[model samples]
Target: MAKKPEDKVLAQNKKANHDYFIEETIEAGIVLQGTEIKSIRNAKVQLKDAFIRIRNNEAWISNMHISPYEQGNRFNHDPLRSRKLLLHKKQISTLIGETKRDGYTIVPLKMYLKNGFAKVLIGVGKGKKEYDKRDVLKKKEAKRDMDRAFKERNQ
Candidate 1:
């Protein structure tokens, strides 16, 4: 058996994990302009403050900032343009239904290249409350402490 090639990650939204409880995740293709793809290939993209929205039965990603390609000049794409997501009709319908519920949202977790095309990992997530964020932080701290103690004992 042969191992599969790993995806080349372009950008990731690290804050998404802290702000949302991801219930499910799905990979979807993105429509990019010429310069946009070039910028992405150079790993000049940002997923912070980016989110997915279902409108008219279609999925769109907004607020994702892809820096303009240095050589693109006047043909550079917009940094914060809304990009269409390619998902099956069934997947779109399911997302629509799930997002109708209170506190549920569609968020972009990461962007990566698969094969030769750009793909985004979107998640169905529920908003985290203040207390929930605090709880997660506390647990992370506890885990870090335990790992440190274990390392010391082993040493």
Candidate 2:
């Protein structure tokens, strides 16, 4: 197998996990202009508060902010405009079918440069309830307490 290119992951939507349960992930190519690609390469992209929606049998990502290139003059793409995601026919069909269910959504989890091109990792997720969030918090706190207790006991 070929090696994956080394890219500095610019941004991630970590809160997506805390707020929703990720069921599946798919990497999709993004349609970007020249300056938008340059801005992403410089780690100036925001994946937070971004989401994907299927419409007219295609998926569109909205609210992802790719900053304008510092040197670009009158050719900069809009920072928060919707961007199209390229996915295979089968994947799009499957996503459309599954997302039709209740509480399922398409969320952009991360953005990274792949083979010198921009790629977005989209996740199929179900939103978590308030009780679920509290449970996760309680589990995290318990794990931390356990780690501290073990260290104290060892010392």
Compare the candidates by lDDT and give the number of the best one.
1
On residues 1-155, what C-alpha lDDT tens digit does candidate 2 reach at each position? 11232576778899899999988888889998769988888899998899998989899999998899999989998999999999998999999988999999989887887777788888899999999999999999999999999999999
- Give the Cα lDDT of each candidate: 0.91, 0.88
Residue-pair clashes per prediction, in order, are 0, 0
The regions of model 2 sitting more than 4 angstroms off are 1-6
Residues 23-93, model 1: lDDT tens digits: 88888999998799899999999999999988898999999999999999999988999999999999999
In model 2, state the lDDT of residue 1.
13
- Runs of candidate 1 with Cα error greater than 4 angstroms are 1-5
Give the TM-scores of the predictions, in the order they appear. Answer: 0.94, 0.92
| lDDT measured at residue 131 in model 2 versus the true structure, 0 to 100 | 100
Among residues 3 or more apart in sequence or in different chains, the pairs in candidate 1 whose N, CA or C atoms overlap within 3 Å are: none
